[model samples]
Target chain A: NGTLVVAEHTNEKLVPITLNTITAASKLGEVTCLVAGSQCAKVAEEISKVQGVKKILLADNEVYKGFLPESLTPLLVAAQNQFKFTHILAGATAMGKSLIPRVAAKLDVSPVSDIIGINDTDTFVRTIYAGNAIQTVKSKDSVKLITVRGTAFEAAQVEGGSGATEQAPTVDVKNELSEFVSQELTKSDRPELTSARTVVSGGRGMKNGDNFKLLYDLADKMNAAVGASRAAVDAGFVPNDMQVGQTGKIVAPDLYIAVGISGAIQHLAGMKDSKVIVAINKDPEAPIFQVADYGLVADLFKAVPEMTDAMNK
Target chain B: MNPFDEIAVEEAVRMKEKKLATEIVAISCGPQQCQETLRTALAMGVDRAIHVLVDPKDYEGLQPIHVSKIIANAAKEEKADIVLLGKQAIDDDCNQTGQMTAALLDWPQATFASKVEKTNGDLQVIREIDGGLETIKVKVPAVLTADLRLNEPRYATLPNIMKAKKKPLASKKPSDYGVDMTPRQEIVSVEDPPVRQAGQKVENVDDLVGKLKDAGLV
Candidate 1:
């Protein structure tokens, strides 16, 4: 009755989200982390040290280099047949979002997605309507497939475990359907938005992309990630990847500083779980102030630079 | 009827207008009210519509797997070279139909497409990945899901609406496609999220910084 956690990683290193997924998987039962990628032995080795994981299943092959769902789904189905595991879980990252549903469909089971809490082995809680409503779903299927929201769970410690590592039988499932082409990512030295301890986000009130420089300076001072609301992204003040909201990334950083954000409900859905929230907006009636731990009503142009100077001092 | 679907339909029509496609068929699975949604697509320049009729109540809990099975069957029946859909429906927010449909049909898929272009018969799809954009090229007879930035859907004019009334609309049942509508998951309960507590106001940046420092957050 152990759970299989689908590990997320770049070829070089395991992603922090996988640690969170492992933490969620531990709540179900004994945890077995599955590291599927081309030359992922290092990743499997790293996962074996995670506190809650009991075993590591390594599937190394060239077919898995890109993490395409078409190729990965068959591997999962094959893994399930061999292990006969009761639960399969992954973090609700981009790769998980693309992979889990297809696997669930192929297995002829319903997939509970973006779950925030686990009531039992079969019952889970997730939000809907952009966090306005929370729904608790119970899976009647014999095998439960789930994608846990990373922000909702604490990450498992990466040390003090000696889980056994074993090689999974290779399954050849060729998908001529799609091929991996190319990727253009925004390489940044700052922490990822969802995993950052401190985050500084801008909204449409930033006025222009250039104005984000203020946020970047403040973020550098705090060693924080920079994020934006949908308004800022739509207004072309920032890239879509920087957007943090219902339709973007969900983050629960320890400290979240909202600069010039009016705080639409969609935006709040992504960051409401932060440990401490600070809202800075010109409008005193903004919805963001409702959830902020400390609200400052002032023009952001004046306030942001002053805060940055204070932090610098 | 979903805004994302509307964007998909709009993109298909634009492709047809650009001579990249000769015909655009709009298909939906839901209650009769879905016909109105299809009509809007027809008015926007779809060649016809196929309605897979089901009771609205019965469709309430149908999961993405069932919907993808039905849509894949329809695509096979029509011999579709390309299937387009919204990334995710606002109601369920599953974001799985397109990928599942592609898997069911055993075709290529590109999801969360913000920009799509037809180049030398292959489709160049610029997708919105986790933190940036990735452009992939998939052969024809593929599935592409529209994202928010795809395009602003155009309104159907009154004259186009009148003409749409005359366009062909075929109705069928889920049984026709041999898809079972049974849901595999059950909803135990739905409730509002806990309300956040009210917060205190700070007078200036100095006060705000002090509060953050007091909380040991700065």
Candidate 2:
């Protein structure tokens, strides 16, 4: 049996989550990753080194750039048809969330999303109600389509594999549906929020956009990514991309430090899966304290600077 | 109503007010209780509502594929020019229905749309993606999933809620749309997620740093 993982990648490098998906895919069967992008040979070469991968199916085409779901959906269906893959998987990031559902629809199969645990070839575990409940589901679809939550799975090694690379069969990737206009990606020196080891987040208590510098200073000291709560984003203290909540990015970093943030249930859903949660809020009764592994009740304006200095020292 | 879906309904109302849309139709696939959500949509100024009624027992079995099919059929029946929906359902968080529906209808889709504007019958949609934002252009007969930043939904006024009672609300079964609601996956069990117990409360930054070192986190 073979499982096909639709690799997530930039033109030059493989997204790290794809490696995590490979780890999840390896649990199923012989892992083959489909790398579809423009000038993506580097990405294919990178996946070839991933430990669990047995083969890399490279599809280099201009249409694959931006990883548009409309174009990629047809390629995935065609690949599944030609290969007869029993399972198709991708990391449950924004790209995967947008593409897999359409592929599942075209294939006339159900798509299971953001699965955390694989019970067997057919059964999987996933969280629902914004992490309030965990459900184990067994798939009956002939071709199982799934999106793996990157945080839930350990990443496969990006080195020490000898997978062969093959040219994927061509498919009609042209679509009259949507055209890409432009993208405004945040160019940050720190790690990505979803993949970071440490994340220091600010909330409404930060008061204004300038006050976010305190959290940023602390984040830089800890080598952590800077994030914000929905309250902070809604209050115009930061952009929506920094938001961590049920509707925003879900993160499960090793250390998630909440500064000046009250943990709303939605906010808790995003970061509660973190390994060690630390809350630095003035209010002791804030919901954030209930989940924190190390809660320090103090003024973040004063405490964050102190913590940054202490960590640096 | 799902919070994102509420934003969808609000966007539809705004589009109608801008004369960009002639009508706004809202659809919900769930148990009978879903009608309450539909009423809310109507109260938010949708022209009408369609409730694809499934029993609670069967509702658990109805996945996004079935919902997409039901929605696709309704879109065809209504001769709709545009389909607006939430990026993900708050209950299941499937985040699939919009894309799947677009595929089934062979229409373009803009999922996780933070901003949508109509220009010469085409929509310029700004989407929320992993790293940041992406803007795209798609013609009508499209599916758009509302993101949180799309708009802050307005509370329905008392008169609007009263008027919503007279709005057209229709109920149909999955079979009516030729959809087989047989579940693809069996739910084995649903349990509470592992609770994280609260740990030591540090008094100061030095204690916090010490705790971090002890945990080998830094």
Candidate 3:
């Protein structure tokens, strides 16, 4: 049985998530990457070099320009028909999050989402209840559809044996029920939150949006990505994209700095995997201290600036 | 019901108020307790409620596929023009039902909708994507899943609650729609996450910075 790894690529390049998905797919069986987008021949060429990939299914079309699930699902189903793949895998990114469920429903199967570990072909481990509980699930379905959490797996190397690329069978794309309008993205020069090496996060204790500038200043000094607890995002102190918690982005950076966060369990779930955690808050009993490698019970307003100054020196 | 679902209902009510919709029908599939959730939606200005009844034990581990099938049946039976749901249930965090339902129905879906507006018979949905916001336009009779920033739900006042008691609420079993409720996945085990050991506290910024330097993190 072979596995089909659904590849995610912006029109320009393949997203980092595809590499992680490829790594997960390698664990199951022979990896066949499915790259579907307009002007994606170069992307398919790049995927052909991933370490575990044995083949690439290229579907280039103008209709699949946007990462629209409506246009992508039929392509996947058609690909599945041609390949008869036993397992289908994708990264738990936004596009995957939206697309996989629809694909599974169309195939009349259930999907095991955000999987952290692949114990075997049938059994997998995943977090539930906002990471408070872990569940090991076994699928009874013949075709296993899975969305892997990228942070839990290492990325596949780019240099390896060349895989053969083939044209994927095309499906009709004229039945689109929705039209894409516009997008507003946060253009940042910093590293992406999920793949950043160091992350500095603030919480509701930041007081207001203006106070978040302090976090940005510190992040710039350390070359770290800026993050926020759900409380901070909910309070409108920061945009939802910066949120680092159960409902937002999950990250496992080399170093994680939590400032003024009270350490809600949801927030901890997203970053508890960081290599080293440092907590800075006024409250001595904040829950974040429990997980921190180093804890400081000081007013963040003073400590953050002092810490930034010390790091600069 | 989840807070995001409440926001979906609130959006429906706002659409009704603007004369974009004539009536609102809220539906849910769960145990007997779900009837109360549907009643709450009626109290919040929905016209009617449909309870796709199932025993709690029978539906305990049912996956999103089964749930979407039941909802698609309900929507077909009601001839629903649009289906609105929470992007994900806070309990399971599956975030699959709305998209799956749309696919099963062969209709369009716009998930993670932070803002919803009805203009000239089309739904303009601003979605919360991975790194930013994306807006899409879908013809009416589409599926839209509500996100956190959609809108704050209004409280059901005492008078509205009294009025809701007189509204129509219909309950039907999943078998009535020829939907199978068996789970596709089996739970091998559920366990607590590994606990992190408590760490040592430092006196001040200097002590904190010193520990950082010791760890070679600076």
Task: Judging by DockQ against the true structure, name the best candidate.
Answer: 2
TM-score of 1: 0.96
* Each prediction's fraction of true contacts recovered: 0.74, 0.88, 0.84
If you score just chain A, what TM-score does every candidate get?
0.98, 0.98, 0.97
lDDT of 1 by residue, B118-208 (tens): 8787888888888688877787899999987888899999999999999999999988999988767789999989888758999998988
Worst lDDT window (10 residues) for model 3 chain A?
A170-179
Q: Assign candidate 3 its CAPRI class.
A: high
The regions of model 2 sitting more than 4 angstroms off are none
lDDT of 1 by residue, A80-197 (tens): 9999888999998778888887888788777888999999999999998888899988888999989989988889999998899998767876766666777888899998988999
Q: Name the candidate, 2 or 3, with the larger TM-score value.
A: 2
Clashing pairs in 2: none
lDDT of the candidates, in the order given: 0.89, 0.91, 0.89
Q: Which is the winner by lDDT between candidate 1 and candidate 2?
A: 2
TM-score winner = 2
DockQ of 3: 0.81
Model 3 reproduced share of reference interface contacts: 0.84
- lDDT at B184, model 2: 83
DockQ of each: 0.74, 0.86, 0.81
lDDT (10s digit) by residue, model 3, range A63-137: 887778988999999988888898999998778889999999999989989999999999999999889899999
In candidate 3 the C-alpha lDDT for residue B15 amounts to 81
Write model 2 residue lDDT over B1-218, tens digit each, in one string. 88888999999999999988898888888888889999999998998998988978888788889899999999999999999998998778889999999999999999999999987778999999888899998978899999988999999999999999999999889889999888888889999999889887988889999999998998
Q: Of models 1 and 2, which has the larger TM-score?
A: 2
Interface RMSD of each: 1.2, 0.9, 1.0
